[model samples]
Target: MKAKLTDAFVKNITPPASGRLDIVDETTPGLVLRVMASGVKSWSIRYRPKGRKQLRESYGTYPSTSLSDARARAKALTAAASVGRDLVSEEAAAAAAKAEEEAKAKTIADVVADYIKAHVAKTRKAGVTEKLFANHIVPVLGKKTVGELRRADVVELLDSLKNKGWRTNAQVNRVHAALKACLNWAVEREYLDANPAAVVKKQVTERPRDRVLSDGELKAIWEATDVRTDPSRAFIRLLILTGARRDEIRCMTWSEIDLEKGIWTLPKARNKGHRDHVVPLSNEVKAILEALPRLGECVITTDGKIPYAGQKSLKESLDKAVGASNWEHWTLHDFRRTVTTGMSALGVREEHRERALNHAVGGIGNKVYDRHAYLDEKRAALQAWADRVMLIVDTSGPQNVVAFEAS
Candidate 1:
């Protein structure tokens, strides 16, 4: 059937018995309306260039591509066909190129995922790297394609983290390094031309932290711990008493502990040093462990299956208990620092303090040949530190201080 195409005419048209119903517009030659047997309707242009085969190019679906729209598109295709241009093949080629581009494009989040799977997952620092991405990078630049990320975006993220007091300069730098490594990997893999993070300068120069808690602050924190519930108080006190890393305490397991031998043997896989470390359990640490319920695998667990992960809330409660004004910018890791410094002040040996902190002391002799576990020295240092911490918390002065032989 042939007629001037109209909305009413198209709507009234019905599907044929077995094949499609074709309605050609008198206004635009070769412009056709197709109604499928399934009742689907679409507008298309059928054209043959002067020297080429017949071809069809769909304008769009029925109501979406209205009568006017179909006629205008058909007129353009008819004129192009007369000039010897195959519009259908040109559109198809352009579509193929676009699809190829889309297939190859990788977003920042995609690159980050690849970087973690291909590289960070193999390292001992995988957990730290993952936290860096989750807490900092992904929220800002994850959706942007790798090729489109700019140095300004990198700088802005770091600035936001610092300006908002979300993380320290050192922490922001660690995040920056993670981003740089990820972008560099993308470049190496030809996913990106260059690393935008590589050129971005650190917003603040990272000075090594020497922020040890003062005696008064320690006393306040100790007093504060008393107000918190089971696992939190135990967790904070262990960080102070044993001088172990925060994650080590959080992920501490019953299987790693030997109550009979008074040892917490951390496996090589979990330790930052990538070597098995034996932490001597002092009387103070032992008491804390003994008092804890035998929660499935983790010692300091609330659910009995997995370890406690809500440190942010714990810290908030602690700050409230301690009176936030009393302490200045202290973190859980700082408790480890406070313990080490207190040991030094108590006349503990340098080697003994390093060993207690599980630091891999430099030098080939120290790394390769130091088979001495220094169990006795560590035990003594921890005991002294615990005694000092107890005295600070006691607030009763002379009577509460326990005497211990300095290592």
Candidate 2:
């Protein structure tokens, strides 16, 4: 009588909107769909919103929905409301709001983002950390919810590396540390249960590297690189003299170096150590710096942009040169090791040498208390080492002067 309440009832109206609509039944009385002026009909359940008199909740459109299903849903809602379960409108809305707030409590990925944002300066300069994650970390676990990750997840990820297990472990350990820092931050903010990475013990594998160039070998590379027409030949000479990391040298611009001050300032953005690093230029370094093209923006680019290919060309040339030297199983990183080794022989202390290379070191002591990096002395020590390397480069005869005691 009052608009026939059965499932077979005919629809008497259309919605004004262009989109389709339908009608559905709910446990409530007199809350039927009054389809609008449009051609489509959407099934809607009439209900009350919090503090509101009445409203229509759109469930779905017709044809796409079935009659029996609509009746079944209405029966459930009517049952819940009958037992004093505030209708789905108010209760579900409240539950959804609570769930959203819980989501903001912080996940591993969120914490990681916070860590990165906090140290934007450091990540910008020493692009190595950013690069490691961009190439490996985010690709592997970027979408993973931090709170949902377990120790097994970390182990399984490393295990999946197959042949690259060691490399994966080293990288995975870093990502693990990154996760730990994020969780600890969450803990400080009263957000996390505990740091998951804290319980995970990573495997240790020692990789011994022996990559110092000999006197004749250094001479061959020097002569060969010097004869090349590319401006990077001079840059390669600078790399040898400075012993700075690849990105440090690669992203350099004319604005950074000051021959008069005997100084080069690496902005906080590109520094690995998250501190503004100062490099003291040596005599050989001076010659190489002077030889670079001062045109456009960057010290290396013709288009005034940093090379998208960081050091691929230099690396290829180095591989070919190493092939000529018949040196096998060595790499460009050995040059960095060579600097540290050479410095130790030349009498640089442990902390100073570590600072020179801008290494982030951890030991039983540093964890005891927070310690700022030894930046000032590190600058001096690096300059002295640069001079020493130049001396070794000039006087390379027979003795392996660039000897380092491995830890």
Candidate 3:
């Protein structure tokens, strides 16, 4: 069918009962209106570019594509085809280029996810690294692509954290380190040309913590923990008694402990040093462990499935119970330092103190040649420390502090 196409004709056209209808526009050559049996109408232009085969391409749908607009587009396409230009092929190529660009444009979050899967997940630090990205980096700069990330953006993020008091200068430095490490990985993998965080200096100078708990403060914390038999109290008591890292005590499993031998064996995967460490349990630590019910696999768990968490809340409750506003702010790690410092004050050998804390003692020669586990030395140091702690917490207990002689 052929006619001078008009808006009224286009809108009022009825669908054929079978097959389809094509109405050629008399006003424009090669321009067509296709009406299907389903009553849907569309516009297209049929043209041949130079020596190429004839091609028919749909331009738009009606009446959304006005009759005048469709005619103009069809004329333009036809004129281009006569001059040996393939408008359809050009459009296709442009679209392909756009898709390729989009594929190359990976966001920071995308690269972080890849980094975690490729590298971080294989290490024991996976949990902390993943949590850092999720809680801090992703929420702030996840949407920005690698090319879009600027040093100013990173500075803004750190400044925002400091301005809001969300993190201390030391903590800001840690976040910067983790973020820089991740970006450096991206650079290594060619996801980024360079790490944006590389030039960003440490926001604050971080001094090593020298806040060892005093005997009086230790006694107060020990007494404060006496009110409950929950996991938090048990966790704190073990931390004070054994002087182990917080997670070492928190993640302790029944299988790792030998009540008969009085040793807790920490596998390399769980420790910060990535070496198997044997922590000698004092009689005090054993008593605390023995008193707890066998609820689950983890020793310090309310449920057996997972280890106890939320140390910050536990610290707050302990501070409130101790009611010591005059005391300096302290961390759970201070218990470990206090134990070592107390051992020193009591004249315990430095090697024994280091061994009790599972620290590497001496040089590479000692580490490679001295395969000795130093179990006995660690036991003596921890036992003496426990004795001192017991006496401090309870003045009614023995007054003499047991000391470990140097080997």
Candidate 4:
């Protein structure tokens, strides 16, 4: 059927009884309105480009696509066909280009996921970095595309952390560092052109933690652990006994220890120094280990599966139990400093103290020449520290104090 296409004619047209009905538009050649038996009305243009066979290209549906707009589109398609343009090929190419652009435009979350898989998973910081992103950064900026990231966004993120008091300004500095490092990696991989977090300075100046636990405070904390269960009890005791890092003791595995040799071997991938550290297990530490059941691979596990992860809540409970105002601001990491400080007070040598903490002593010369693991010196220092701890916690027992050679 041939007729001039109008809004009323298109809307009032009835569907065919059987297959379909085609109404040709007299206003625009090659423009056709197809009314389907299902009552679906759609517009399409039929034209042949040069010597090519006739092609039909559907543009839009009626009601949604106005009659005037359909006529305009059909006219444009016919004119473009006259100029040797392949309308179907051009439309397909345009769609492909759009898809390619979308693929390249990765969100911050997408880039972070890639960064973790391609880069972070190979490093020791993988677990903590993943948590930092998941808990802090991702919730705030994950939806923003990499190209859309601005310095303002980073500043706002840090400011929010500070304003909310969820973390201290000092801790906000760490979040900023992690964010900057991730963005830097993204820039290197061409996922981002620049790091928006680069110019974002620290929220506040962080002073070196000089807070050391006194003898009374340490005793109170030790006694508080008595009320706690296996993992928390043993974990805190080991931190004070060996002065090892929190995670080093938290993620301890049964395979890393040799009870016969009284040594806990930390792999290079785990420690901060990135070197295999041999912590001489004092009698106290060995006793704690022996007391713990062989639940699974992880020595400090509560469930016989993964490591214990309730330190934060445990600390809160401990603070409440200890009930000392002086112990208010102390952290788990402060135990490390207190151990080293107490050793200094006990006349332990500087090198021995550093060695006990697995800190690199002296210059590159010492690192190259002094291949000695200092097992004896570290053992002596740790024993002295452990004995001091025992004396503080249990005044009833006769303390066996080990003598340390002077520096």
Candidate 5:
């Protein structure tokens, strides 16, 4: 009736004639091996709960469970039962808790998807922002849970970009900002306790850029555009003439322009300032627009439908032209600064200059209360800027003008 359960005994034991055979281990009390008529053996513990009938809990199958492990598990169950604790209920609660935690733990990639859908996708730069995260953040930390993400983890990710020279310091800062925004959104949604990036400092120190093009350099750049084609030539000229952001010009649609009115009205969606921006097109700028064939909805497009995406090639051609002049280093964005700097030198008032560049000025009162579009002032500034640029380009030495090779 009672004996020590061993591996050899389990393998040699005979199947019962009808139902099953129960053998209790005398060495370890209450541990039993039940051998069904089909010869299947399983380990279990039978215990009398306090003020309740006896109950059987199957620990595992015989051989697989092993005699020692079954006895250890049975002993623990017996101890719990003796203390009036219901082992079955306790185990079930623990199982449910583990399952709930697993269900609630969300990975970084999961949060990013939700964040993009709810927040980033609605923004104008959604495509760029999405690509930034995909290229920088997602590959390394996507699988890590938000709660487990620490400051060191974020530093590692940013440092990887820096170490690889994958991105510049300014670009690393942008990636950090995107991650911080996503984490903050998580906190606001109650999915996280805090943002790990909140304490992590930005990796790069950003300085105010003061690289303004001189009149000679501007003249060189203006003359260089003649070698380029329709969209590229017009695009570069507009950058100097209108003082608008590159994307604002590149993504310009036919609907946003009113050639008769000599205005380019950028809705809040296309504008970085997130407000309706009206740029007074100079006569020269209007001429470029008038000459552009309406192939599609957008203005600066080779195919007429899609926005121009040949910035890299365009920049190379521009560099070749600028390089010929032995001009100092400059970027396309420098043109905006060039226009702004040039306007200031030409005695354009601060407020109108800021407005011409579509920069938000003053406090909430000015932004919220000032309804004036300053159409006349803006028109005058553009006309003056265009006039000054034309004068500079005309004065460029014959050798300063070079043709940009066609793509």
Candidate 6:
């Protein structure tokens, strides 16, 4: 064993190597030092624990980790390990040592990119996930690396979302989901020891989806659609009647609709889930489509032109409709509920209801062949929903709940 000396005496002694090569300090067994050569000046504690083989722990690079501090840390760990602390405990001790500055080593931007490229892109539609990350996650956290990010950094970003309201919160929540997904990947890749974002919670500032519309609200939409000469009114009303996704509606073309067949075919590419779908249309929907001024290839046209471009076109018109009404806190999407709720009240079969809305549940293959040959029953249910919606719009009444014996 090397002779033990006080801290001052150990600090004074310089090894044979040049000034760059350092004698870090004494450890649990003996004096520890390093000889610098390449860009990395690594430290080694050449000592043995009690009843153990000799081994050296490479602490870190030099100048970056000062010789004095490195020696002091090595001595503490070696002392702990010598006292019979297990491997797991030693690892925990090592992690605690590295947590502070090293955690900050990864920037948000770098980790986000890696996580997207490595994991998220593979599972989700690359374009959709890319659009989401680019629009929301990267703007605030892009510059920072994985290690540098902390809980407060995430919290601060979340707090900024409060000003923009629910839609913004939707974006924020998605950003967090993307970040959590990416950071977990970092941990798996050994880029990080643990994911700091796993525990973060999304604050619920907005009310839960109570999307069922009210009596007066129904009346306003009805009056607007009924009296307005424009066919787009009927299209918006059908959106409420059908309960399909807005994108599904926006991209609808004439080829997809069969007036005689009484069905609308939504191609897989246009669906949010990227699956081919068919919507069971109501007579009210049929009447509306029949009345619309067809523009080009789309159904919702005025003078042979697609009304505006996408949902933005539809939303802009709806926004104008909303401005004309005496309303508070309602949107076009509430129609999906309008159909689902209206049907259940009118004794519609659950399977028929789900199918009518083109909701793909029970996986892709099951959805493909789960046809009931009950198109008449489904048409009746959809028509019932449309009737109820019209009744509410016509009379400004609430849900006309007509209970039936359970099937």
Ranking by lDDT: 4, 3, 5, 1, 6, 2
**Which model is ahead, 4 or 5, in terms of lDDT?**
4
lDDT of 5 by residue, 62-125 (tens): 7788888988988888888888887887989999777556534888999899999999999999
Candidates 1 and 5: which is better by TM-score?
A: 5
Give the Cα lDDT of each candidate. 0.84, 0.61, 0.86, 0.88, 0.84, 0.66
Off by over 4 Å in 4: 1-104, 324-328
* Candidate 4 residue pairs that clash: none
Which is the winner by lDDT between candidate 2 and candidate 6?
6
Model 4 TM-score? Answer: 0.74
Query: For model 5, what is the error of residue 260's alpha carbon versus the real structure, in angstroms, after optimal superposition?
Result: 0.9
Query: Positional deviation of 63 in candidate 2, in angstroms?
Result: 50
Model 5 TM-score (2 dp): 0.70
Across residues 1-407, which tens digit of lDDT does each residue of candidate 4 receive? 99998889999998999899999999899999999999999988898787677889898888898899888888877887897787778989999777655644889899889888988889876888898899999999999988788999999999988998763578788789888998898888667667889988788898898989988999989999888888889999999998899999999999999999999999998999898999999999999999999998999997779999998898888888888554458889999999999999888999889988989887988888878889998898999999999999999967788666666
Estimate the lDDT of model 3: 0.86
Ranking by TM-score: 4, 3, 5, 1, 6, 2
- What ranges in model 5 sit over 4 Å off? 1-104, 324-328, 363-365, 396-407
Task: Output the lDDT of residue 8, model 5.
Answer: 91
Instruction: List where candidate 1 sits over 4 angstroms from the true fold.
Output: 1-104, 122-128, 160-167, 395-407
- Among all windows of 10 consecutive residues in model 3, the one with the lowest summed lDDT is 398-407
Work out candidate 2's RMSD over C-alphas.
12.2
lDDT, candidate 3, residue 82? 91
lDDT per residue for candidate 3 within 111-213, as digits (tens), equals 8898899988998768877988898899999999987999999999988777867534677887788899989987876666778899999888888889998
Instruction: Give per-candidate clash totals.
Output: 0, 18, 1, 0, 1, 15
Worst 10 residues of 4 by lDDT: 96-105
Model 2 stretches astray by more than 4 angstroms: 1-127, 140-143, 165-169, 186-192, 206-211, 227-231, 266-278, 324-328, 343-407
- Displacement of residue 198 (Cα, Å) in model 2 is 2.6
